[model samples]
Target: MEYLLFRLYGPMASWGDPAVGSDRPTALRPSRSALLGLVAAALGIRREEQSLHDKLAASVTFAVKQYSAGVLLRDFHTAQVPSQDKKTIRRTRKDELQTGRLNTVLSIRDYRCEGLWVIAIELTEDAGWDIRQLKEALLKPKFTLYLGRKSCPLAAPLSPKIVTSDCLRSALDTEFEPILKDSDADRVWLPKSDRVTYYWQGRKEATNLTGVSSDKVWDDPVHRQRWQFSSRTEHSASKHREE
Candidate 1:
């Protein structure tokens, strides 16, 4: 019955993909994990806070509209790595902290430029943080809020507001317009029909993706000091202006 609306606009955004290696690919749209991470950071909740993450995941429902897919921009990077072992480290420490001689490694990160997505998060139950708390946190976040990566800072304010809607389509239709960038190539992917694609917890991707399905919560860092995700249900929705 209540939803929190916000906008994610950035010069460049890197919505992570399921890739697991040197080349960190990005998804076309923001992943469930990324959304949760944004909220946690805004609330100043540490990554080690597992219980908080679980509560947030279970208490709220998330949906995003891919207004602009943007163009893919690949960044070429050469970084130092441990000469000895360790699968890979996300951050490199000082030169002296290395356990062994540092080795130069090549890493590629993909990003989307001129991208914009409208996010609608609904409180499914009277659990976890309240919408008011979330709005306040976003306004004065303890930690810096980036689109998906720290390198890509948000280009605009979240401008979060509360709305009344039972479904994402109606919620969006009431406010959003399909604004595309100057470049037509960045047009968003469209379904066979003008339907908003939705992804909710435990929602299965039926023959039609418009349905909901269960998905992994990839942003959980507290369970173990590793990149892990627990199961959660999410929903998605989409519509084409031409239709």
Candidate 2:
């Protein structure tokens, strides 16, 4: 099986909640839909294409790395209102104003410069898709696609190979070297290790400092560690479906 991992990062990123309306928006952690949309746009798929939706059901995950967290608001410029000509006013009474025209203005709110998040998309194809094809499609000069927000662009290259569980663990350890280790031969796990799921937000305790023993400090939940793991079960299923 093959996969595509993206290292998403930028000055600002806004991944909205699925329940938000067009006017009112709320930012949430990355979701499956947002990631799929990014992949679709990278592949240059049109909105009318059904294949993209069908192909997205395979196992996919989003690993968000929060370097900084903040919010931003923007104003809306364009809005329309009812005209007085040939328009019936909904309410006309002694207590109500007789004006037939009403003006309405709208504003847009969004998140501004925030931290970076790495989104790794795992794509499994049995027919054997080339990693270079995925890379070329992503790094194209005119490509304007993004995982969640326009400002948030991919960080690392798209690796089109299934990353093993051990490899994923090792990668995280390597990325966060001193934090995950106390000494050359002794590595200690945090107290909140069981909650070490994807997108775990936890505070870095004092023990998390360099040269400190893991037992010397308390474990505070601040931000969760985000990682992706794929196993043989998924590999076999993806192969059967493709065939």
Clashes of each: 25, 13
Alpha-carbon runs more than 4 Å astray in model 1? 85-92, 95-100, 176-224, 231-238
lDDT computed for candidate 1: 0.69
Displacement of the residue 126 alpha carbon in candidate 1, Å: 4.9
User: Which candidate has the top score in TM-score?
Assistant: 1
Tens-digit lDDT track of model 2 for 110-191: 5544333334444454423355565566666234666466656654343323343333322322232222334632543222
Residue lDDT tens for model 1, 41-136: 888878887778777776766777666767889999998766654665536476435566767888989998877777877776566788889888
Off by over 4 Å in 2: 1-3, 19-22, 57-59, 74-78, 81-102, 124-132, 147-197, 200-243
TM-score of 2: 0.49
Q: lDDT at 206 for candidate 2?
A: 11
* TM-score of every candidate relative to the true structure: 0.75, 0.49
Model 2 Cα displacement at 35 (Å)?
A: 1.5
Looking at model 2, residue 102 earns an lDDT score of 52
